[model samples]
Target: MKREKLNEMKMKFRALSSNEGFARIVTTAFIMPYSPTVEELADIKTAVSEAVTNAIVHGYRSNGDKYVSLTAVMYSDGSLTVSISDKGCGIPDIHKAMEPLFTTDAENERTGMGFSIMETFTDKLRVVSRVGEGTRVTMTKRLSVFSK
Candidate 1:
């Protein structure tokens, strides 16, 4: 489909585990205007939750002082892209991190499937991280007339 920008928004909030729910709710609201299907809404919410949780728990190490940012863009063809970012300790290996059950913090019972989960729910997933800098996870899902 030809891509044309329809709507977009960016938000930054404190990186606190408590804010994870807020992130999920905000993302749902952000895309609700498009009249997404129940499954699409659930998928988006879960993806947002996983990304935000990773930012607060793993990215900031639960510091509660740093911040996590989220951005959403809608294209004319019924596609949506969501970007979740954090400016905390960055990932050392993007590949290994994407592996299932590979948790950097094993003591916390992390499943190490955050990346995979996001990838499964979204049509496309891209992760960029730099040590001591931060991580940005962007996922795209198609939600347009043709999809219906």
Candidate 2:
């Protein structure tokens, strides 16, 4: 079903590990007016952090020179959708990559839980990628408004 978008925002930043926090903060600020609960906010932040970190570490292979783009949309039904895209080496096997404890960089002590964490935090998660091209991770969540 299609929902009317109340607001939208897009940003592009260098694919640096340090920028992961920046992305999370920006996403939180964007959704603040919707009055999400503390738990909801934390979940979104964690998913955003994982998505951005994946774009920086796996997509770009820690190449700070690469770029990642993030787009967020707020729907009238209190749902928010966030998409993160990276113009770097894409996932060759998305299914295998998303499996638990499946890390291509095990030598780096990577937990291989990024996708799992994102999936757990968001209501819906979709990933699109092409080898040697790029990858885009889209996540959506329905926010339960908090009242004080």
Candidate 3:
């Protein structure tokens, strides 16, 4: 298959509960045209929601003063790349965070499954973080003609 490069879309929103839904909606709207099925849309939206939720709940701790950034890029091969980041309490151990049912906050019934869900939904997942700095999660999926 020939690779085709497309433009990228980037947006940043405050790490607030209300903005989470907006982020998911905007992302879905932008990628929906290339998505093949409703299942794919749900998957993408859920993955994005998980990422944003993590940023708001874990990263900003519901402060709502911080900001979360999202970026989407279409590759030449019809692959979609998404990046969600927050400058908050960084993950101490990414491997452990990615593990299912491992959450630092359990009192809230977090389930610690956010990372796992994101991983399951997207074709690729990458996380970058510092102890006290912040975290960046990038996910990718191949967009096929049948995806729509």
Per-model TM values vs. the true structure: 0.95, 0.95, 0.92
Worst 10-residue lDDT window, candidate 1: 139-148
Q: Say what the RMSD of model 1 is.
A: 1.3
lDDT score for candidate 1 against the true structure = 0.90
Going through the candidates in the order shown, the clash numbers are 0, 0, 7
Candidate no. 2 TM-score: 0.95
lDDT of 2 by residue, 1-148 (tens): 5669999999999988889989999999999999998999999999999999989989999999888999999998888999999988999999999997899998988899999999999999999999999999999999876212
- lDDT by residue (tens digit), candidate 3, 1-148: 6666576899989888999899989888888767547777788889999999999999889888788999998876767888999999999889999899999889999999999999899899999999889999999977667344
- Over 4 Å off in model 1, which ranges? 144-148
Q: Give the per-residue Cα lDDT of candidate 3 at 109.
A: 92
After TM-score superposition, the amount by which residue 23's alpha carbon in candidate 2 deviates from its true location, in angstroms, is 0.4
lDDT of 1 by residue, 19-113 (tens): 99999888898888889889988888999999999999989999988989999998888899999999989999899999988998888888888
Runs of candidate 2 with Cα error greater than 4 angstroms are: 146-148
Candidate achieving the largest lDDT: 2
